[model samples]
Target: MAKNTGASKFRKVNVDEYDEENFQDNEDADVGVVGPNENEVSNFLNQSKNVEALKAVLQNPPQGCKDKRLKDKVVQVVVRVLSAFKTSDIEKGVNALDSQSLDTLMKYIYRGFEFPSEGSSATLLSWHEKVYAKGGSGCIIRVLTDRKTL
Candidate 1:
């Protein structure tokens, strides 16, 4: 038998010797779901003061709702934009909303509240209060009472 020693028995790995071509991209990458279009939309919503852009996005969200990742991205963008709205801006936006837009807004509110860590729920609630204060209670009440909303 060989004499005992305190040195490690295992050989050291030389990372530089690994073949790069054989390595595939990680399937579980931490990259988020937001695509370029979603990024553009979120950027426009964040950087632009134009309410019309927001109105357009709210009126017609990107249509891949079947994909949970896409749906989450859409919801995230909407909530971020809505959370940035001022009371007057929200009141004006609420007033300009037709029935369809109102439904969309209600969806946003529901989704916003679904994930509290996003922090948009508080903004939505505050906006609701502002709507009531602006005498738009009927609109909010109609949305809240809608069977499709919950």
Candidate 2:
């Protein structure tokens, strides 16, 4: 909810005529329910973050996740991200990230290429920016590995 703007001069202001359209977009927004335009709202940090996701990556990754480097990278990424949350929080965090970001992680765990162990920092960062922008949980560790920091 919008913060009370300096409170009302008399702690309450009631106008008989209420025009919702006059309010700014967010002003009329409802939490845990609807967006300003009345679209369904999401719980950003809950649904996506789940213990099952980490477990899923470890258990039945896409394919070819057995490479030591790729395994370590995926493990590190999952561990690092999972470390920050209580077991209960994973589902929420996972839900928050966008599909593309999740796909990147899935690729890393399943099919991401090692590529001669040399590549652009920008390339990795760009990959993760998509991940992070969609609110993915992991930090930029794969970025470090791509840069040979591992």
Candidate 3:
């Protein structure tokens, strides 16, 4: 009869040596401090005294912003400014945007879809149509594939 040895079955496991929670989640700690300030855009809109300036400010969104909450505030402001524009102005606004601004606008358009309000969808759709016509599918791909969210 062969003797059964527990030594072969069990190797030492230093539980303290291995970290059970080694994974690190993306930090949003700097969200409040970093990214575009809501007041800055709002103030600029006031100072410029023109809705067209909204497009300008949006064109230069805070570089490397990954904060969704901060971006959402800006989008809300954008949608409001967009809503204020006349139908004729919408086309002009879309036309005025450069490729970079178009992509940013597309991102806002998609984000606006998440919280549909009265008549907001129609406005977003109008903007989307104009942007898609101008930028084509590539613009959307860039927005979708980007790791740094607006």
Candidate 4:
């Protein structure tokens, strides 16, 4: 007698059981639409070259005391953009930043240090260290200062 194998217990599935018509194609499916104006910061960051644009936006922020949310968004965008700066760009970027922009960056860093769990404090510190190493005098001085105003 032939020895029975586990393969003998398996049954072949019907090829016709799968309905191709019922299957949806994800290639053209609309996952979701991302509007340009919806998340300006994310849209700006997604661009190929946005340093100039970011600087312009930072220099001329939205006018109005009620635009606190917009100001926060700008801060978030600045932090993200600054964090993305390469070592070679750090010095130039740091130099180009106005005092207000610097203060904004410092505020974000200070918030991170104040609330370790809420933000990327360590990442910010590392970026500052990188900037310092790359001869970013302004960034180094700003980071070293103990001013609570920022």
Which candidate comes out best when scored by lDDT? Answer: 3
lDDT of each: 0.62, 0.40, 0.72, 0.51
RMSD of each: 15.4, 19.6, 6.4, 18.0
| Model 4: colliding residue pairs | none
TM-score of each: 0.55, 0.24, 0.66, 0.41
Models sorted by lDDT, best on top = 3, 1, 4, 2
Clashes of each: 0, 16, 0, 0
**Cα deviation of 26 in candidate 4 (Å)?**
56
Question: Candidate 3 regions off by >4 Å?
Answer: 1-51, 60-68
Whichever of 2 and 3 has more lDDT, that candidate is 3
Candidate 4 positional error at 68, Å: 9.5
Relative to the unseen true structure, what is the C-alpha lDDT of residue 32 in candidate 2, on a scale of 0 to 100? 37
Provide the lowest-lDDT 10-residue window in model 3.
Answer: 27-36
lDDT value, residue 42 of candidate 1:
62
**Candidate maximizing TM-score:** 3
Off by over 4 Å in 4: 1-38, 53-76, 114-119, 126-150
Residue 148's lDDT in candidate 4: 30
lDDT of 3 by residue, 67-134 (tens): 56766677777787667666767777778778988888888788888878999999889888888999
Candidate 4 lDDT, 1-150, residue by residue in tens: 987676843367665557886664334233232211325645666673456544644554332323456545554555565556565665666566666666445545554454343345656776566435544566646656733322
Model 1 Cα lDDT, one tens digit per residue, 38-134: 5555666657653655575575543333456666766777777777677567777667766666666666677677667666667889755654554
